[model samples]
Target: MDVDDGRTARARPSSWAAVAIGTVAVIWLAFWVLKAVFDVVALLFAGVLLAVFLHGIAGWLSRRAHLPAGWALAVTVAAIVAVLGAGVWLIAPSLAAQVDELSQRLPEAARRVADHIERYAWGRRLVERLSEAQGLPQARQALLGATRLLSTTLGALTGVIVVLFVGLFLAAEPAAYRRGLLRLVPIARRARAATVLDDTGHILRRWMLGKFCSMAAVGVLTWIGLSLLGIRLALALALLAATLTFIPYLGPVLALLPAALLGLLQGPAMAGYVIALYLGIQLVESYLLTPLIQRSTVALPPGLILAMQVLLGALTGGLGVVLATPLLAALVVLVKRVYVEDVLGDATVDQGEGAPLPGLPEQR
Candidate 1:
């Protein structure tokens, strides 16, 4: 008995030491692997998000419309294509006109802007300081360099095609793909994977639907307001706002730029109207629309969004930036449902942040 116990104890210690070493090695390997391949991983997560969201819509349509799931899927796909085609048809004329007008007016606008800058007190002080500090020449060169840098990206065209294809394929047969994945996992983990898939579907659908609703509201408001203000290309700017609204934080800010610029071209008073229009839109979005539509998930915090944007942008270029939040939401849902709910314990009713976002899909 003594010999057997001694041998068992010795073996246990050795096993524990080996396990510790293996754990550290795994951590190191995972760190490097994630660093090296975050873009591909991020894209995969984005795929999962798209799949979940589409499936949710399919399910909803199937339920509410009392159609077969397959037929609902077909309708959903048709709706997506129709929306895209209609948007293109609707905005093409206004966009082309706006582009031509901007092309003609940009030089005059630039000259006027320079003159206005030279007249402004802060602008005059900046000019004087730059001249005194011998910064003007360097600043001009730096401005050109910055413009060049902004114009060039590592990968853009290819990434857009990839995202489009990924989103399309994922939406087509998400259940089959998900089931195949869960089957690959151990039998013990299969249930957990199922729950994760369910949770993910819920979160993604809520997010996409809620955001779309809010964006539509914003677009309608923008279109109506700009039309009222006598702005050129009101439809175009409104469409831009709706499209950019998918981006979060930076989106509305970007919408303001073209609106203000167009307003400036129209007249100083019109510029005020444009700014006021966007501001009013922003107010409505924050106070009314978002509250009504986006009451579920708030998305990840701005800092995390910015960090993911920078990271994904660095890795997969702009596609990563665009899909970052959806990707993050998918990850959070998977982790929460599988780890916190399945492995660690049942999900707490008093869970902090509930689902860590405002637009998480309903459990139903």
Candidate 2:
């Protein structure tokens, strides 16, 4: 008996170690496979986020205006399209002209930039270093590489229409679909499940509203500031700023690049004015607009936001970054409420305050 018992005990550690090693290896393989799959579905994720955003707005309009939910959703979606159309109409001509002009002038800019590099002291040293490392003749090769990136950007544009259509469908039928989904939950847990759904919608709605307002404010301020500074491509630049504002810190900085570069091309005085204008716009956005828009929503920690962006971007590139925050925030709420508070919870803590939930009337 003692011999058999000793053998079993000796084998247990080896068995546990084998299981652990096997689990980790399986997990690693699954992670890579999942990343590849996620890349394909990344756009659908963006569509879902958009649907969540529009769905919440639909609910608010339905409740407040006493409109049919479908009609409210239709109205909201139409308003978005109208604003986009109007913006395009206002800027289309100038944007086309600017693109044509840019296509023509870019070569000249490249030549000038090259000439400046050859003439400038710091640029000369950097060129020598790059030449040593890459064995390339000149930095013009790098410029050409950048132009190819613009061509590839057109491919990303193709996904836009697909996402738009998906978003529309989601906006139209969110509630019916969401209810159907909740049917999978056990009857006893349905009330808690419903609360989770409601809270998710609220969090998503507040986030969307806040982002929309912030983007609008930033766009308007950017346009007015750049225009006042006599910066070229003011309208196109403004729109870019607004669109990029969805991206957080990186977006505003990207908007600044064009405005500042154009200002530099104009002269030092124009550049100085452009810098000051942007500074003022930043102040207004940080102090005024953000507070007003975010009043109803909790601010996410900056480090977590950046970390989520990088992680999502690694898995899905651009689309991941677009949907990261709202998804994570909703998930955070779900985790705390469902897993921590409800599932593996301390019953005594809640029992001290109110009657047990199970005994209460279902309607309450």
Candidate 3:
């Protein structure tokens, strides 16, 4: 009996070691699986953002028009579709022409830039070093890269369609989805999870509203500014600026590159003017417009957002970069609400700025 007891005791440690190894193997597998599916997860998160936007609009309509939630959502969707269809019908031809022109002009513009830089000894050396570093791939390689990019874009379009459908379905019955999600949480923590979800949604909706307003303002202002400066492809440049502005710091810099390249094709003075124009517009947008528009949204730190952009971009490519800001915003809300307030027992942390939580009465 003593020998048997001794044997059992010796077996217990080995069993625990085996259990530990199994747990670690499972975790390692999960990590890789999640990494593989990260892109799909990012796309779904994008859909959730869209759903939040739709819910915000639908909620506003429900409140103002006194329509039922479902009817309000239907109206909102129909109105959006009609507006988009009308806008596309009106602008598609001209925008397409401008885009084609811009694309065709860009290569020439780049060549002109190279010629200009080569005129200077230091600039010539710099260009040579850059070409050497890039390995100066053959035309066939460039063509292949372009073909790959085209295929990627097509894949992205498919993803967008999926996101749109997902968003619509989510927006249609958010409460049902919410309940479904809450079911996964412990019963004791379910209320907190629901609150977190609501807070995150409110923050995201406000951010989107502000962002769209800023994008529209930037597009219009850019078109006007470019037209005043007599830049070719004003429409295309404006559209690019507006779309890129959806990203924060790095985006503005990227948007400037093509514009500057085109400007360089015109002249050095024109390039200077274009640079100044973009900087001025950015200053206005950063200081005046964003403050006014995003007053109701959380004041995210620019450095943090930029860091997230860089990290996510490295990890997940362009989609990661695009969604980084919203993801960061959501993370901030979760940290503030869940970690700081609840876990740490500190309610002094500011939950959000600007307006109160959406669909709730304003606190005195």
Candidate 4:
């Protein structure tokens, strides 16, 4: 009997070792699979954001306008199309003219900035090193870098069509998808999963509202300030800043580069004013626009969002960075509900406590 027990114990260890190896292998394969579909996953998340936005608007229509869900969605789509069409009709000509002018002048502005930079010993050496590494002169290297950046922006523009179509379809029959997702969970946990999903949708809807408000406020303020300072292409530049603001931290910086470059074309004083204008606009967003809009949304740490942007940007590029905040918000909701509440028995997760968001019931 003792010999038999010793043999069984030895067999158990081998079985456990095999299980561990299998688990590790499975995890590695899963990571490889995720990497392959990273762009698709990012676009799906963007689609999710769009669905949340459309649903929020549709919910309001259903509740307040006394419309059926189908009709509400139809109205929402029509309204969006009308607004976009009107905006294009009203602004396209002027915007196109400004864009053309900016394009024609930007190379000169860039050359000027390069000249200024090259006046500094450190800048000259850095440019020389970069130029040598690229097997091109400094001027050619700079232009190549700008061309690559513009190409990347164009690539992102192409992805917007995919996100829009996916979002529209998902938003059209969100409840069906919700039901499908709940079925994926264990039968016993489906109810809890439903609650978490609902809460996630609520938080994301609030986030969408907040982002829209911020974008509008920033765009208007930037346009007003630039116009007051008599800066050219104020409308086009303001619109660019507004659109880019959706990407969070890095976006404003990218917007600032062109604004500052244009400002420098006028004079150093004009450049300083432009810098101050952006700083003022950002301060308002940080203090007022953000606070008011985010009051009912999940408040993520800025540092954490920025860190995720860096990590995801490295892995999946621009799309990852753009979708990072919403993804993090969803993760936060899951961790709080699943890990904190269920596993640790902690009831005080502060899942958007305080003022009630519109279209969402008060949290118990």
Candidate 5:
């Protein structure tokens, strides 16, 4: 009995030591891996988002156009390419010229703003303090920051190309890939995994549709409003707003700065109008557009989305910000499905009446 007890005591210490070593090793490896492949991983996620978008379009074409799945996929790809090409053809020259004009006007606008500020004594003191605080360097830093932001996640052409092809491959054989993913799960849990995946796809599709519509509505409205108010670079500002709409709350604010700056150059009245216009558009989106579209989609909390955006943006820069909401949405679905439903044995409520839980197939 003494020998047996001694053996047990010895075995326990060694086992614990081995486990501690393994845990440390795993953590070190994970940190290394993340550091080495962060950008690649981000690109992969971006590809997945693109794949989801393409798959949604392909599915719609198959159902509505009465086309074979393969044909529908092809048609969707071709249509996207054609539309993009047409947009570039139609808008590139004008956009380029406006961008150049804006570049020239921006410095002048800054000077005008600075002068307006200098008119007030407190503003002059603030300006003087700012100037004393390495003014040239600060201005240079500001310019660099702006450049970085404008460049954003689309900085690497090669990365963009890789993501595009990856998306195409994923969209082309999503079922095959999905099946492959299911195979990774234990046999008992494959069905559950499949359900989760399908639910993710459904939510992603709904989000994409709503997002695109929102962007389009915002862009069109901004352009019309800005043009009516005689704002210069209306098209550019509108395009910027539309593109940034993909980023949720933060995007609109970023887009607003340049528009507001341009409006300031016009006059105080025009600037006020610009601000009111932006607020009105946001109000409509919040009250009308979002609710109408999200009726069939998962309603993500704005605070949660904003938090994810900040976290992801800090980690992955522009790409992370763009993808934050979708990632959060997927995480929410998984948590609700796995933790809330499975672990807690509680039914989660949906935003809409009779809305099925994620991972549940909708009844026709």
Candidate 6:
């Protein structure tokens, strides 16, 4: 009996070791699987954000115009399409011309920059280091990278079409989708899940509203400022600035690069003035516009947002960086509602109020 007992103990340890190995293997496989699907998941999340925007507008139209939800949503979509189509039709030619000019001028601008840098001893050293970095192999790698980027851009265009369709479908029947999602949860926890979903949607909607307002303000201000500065391709630069403003910290820096390069083409004084204009615009947007617009929304810490952008950009490239802020915002909501309040028993955390989710009851 003692011998049998010893044998059983030894067997148990082997079994436990096997289990641990299996668990580790499963985790490694899951990680790879998730990495593979991460881009698809990000695209779906982008569609969700678009849906939120559409639904929010439809809700407002429903309330104000006394229209049925479906009709309101249809009107909202039509209006958006019309506005976009009209804007494109009106501005595409001029914008295209400016974009072409900007592209042609940028190479010259870069050369001018290199010449200026060669003037100072420290700048010469910097240029030498840069040149050294851009060896034959590095140049080959850059060509390959550009090729990959072009392919990725094509893929992204397809993804945008998918996102648009997904958004339209989701906005059309938000309740059905919400119910389907909740059905995945256990009956006992489904109510809580619904609440969390509603809160997340509300928060996302507010963020979108604030972001649109900020983008418009930045675009208009940039165009005005660049025009006054006599900067060539002001329209293209303004458009670029407005679009990049969607990505937060890294975006502004990127937008500034082209504008600054263009300014450098003009002269050192113009470059300085261009830099000051961008800085002033950023200041006003960060301090004044955002605070007033997003007062009722949850304020994300700038540091956290920047960190997330860097991490995601490294992991998943441009799409990751573009979607990082909204993804982080949704994550914050989930952590607060699910982990902090539910798991940690800290129910006092204030979840900022916003527009009620299209099909969810308002939580008082």
Q: Compared with the true structure, what per-residue lDDT tens digits does model 5 show for residues 31-69?
A: 667646777788898898899999898988899989988
How high is the lDDT of residue 226 in model 3? 87
Q: Return the clash pairs for model 3, or none.
A: none
Clashing pairs in model 5, backbone N/Cα/C closer than 3 A: none
Model 5 poorest 10 in a row by lDDT: 345-354
Query: Over all chains combined, what TM-score does candidate 4 have?
Result: 0.83
Q: What is the TM-score (0 to 1) of candidate 2?
A: 0.75
- Give the Å shift of residue 338 in candidate 6: 1.2
Q: Rank the candidates by lDDT, best first.
A: 6, 3, 4, 5, 2, 1
| Per-residue lDDT over 170-259 for candidate 2, one digit per residue giving the tens place of the 0 to 100 score | 778877777897999999998899998887777777878888888888888888888777666777778778888888666677777666
lDDT of 4 by residue, 1-364 (tens): 9999999998999999999999999998987787678888898888889988998899999999899988998999999999999999999999999999888888888989889999999989988997778887789979999999999888788778888988898889998999999989999999999999999999999988889889998999999999999999999899999998888888999999899999999999999999999998998888888778667877788899999898788768877888888899899988989998898877766745565654568789
Superior by TM-score: candidate 3 or candidate 4? 3
Q: lDDT scores for all predictions? A: 0.76, 0.76, 0.90, 0.89, 0.86, 0.91
RMSD of 2: 7.3
After superposition of all CA atoms, the RMSD between model 1 and the true structure is 9.1
Cα displacement (Å) at residue 72, model 6: 1.5
Error of 3 at 16 (Å): 22
**How high is each candidate's TM-score?**
0.71, 0.75, 0.84, 0.83, 0.81, 0.84
lDDT of 3 by residue, 40-108 (tens): 989999999999999999999999999999999999999999999998999999999999988999999
Worst 10 residues of 2 by lDDT: 346-355
Candidate 5 vs 6: which has more lDDT: 6
Q: What is the lDDT of residue 283 in candidate 6?
A: 97
In lDDT terms, how accurate is model 6? 0.91
Instruction: List clash counts for every candidate, in order.
Output: 9, 0, 0, 0, 0, 0
Whichever of 1 and 6 has more TM-score, that candidate is 6
Residue-wise C-alpha lDDT for candidate 6, range 1-364, written one tens digit per residue = 9999999998998999999999999998976787688888888999999999999999999999999999999999999999999999999999999999999999999999889779999999999999888776978899999999999899989999989999999999999999999999999999999999999999999998999889999999999999999999999999999999999888889999999999998788999999999999999999998888667667788899989888677666798999999999899989989998889876656744464543458789
Better candidate number, 3 or 6, judged by lDDT: 6
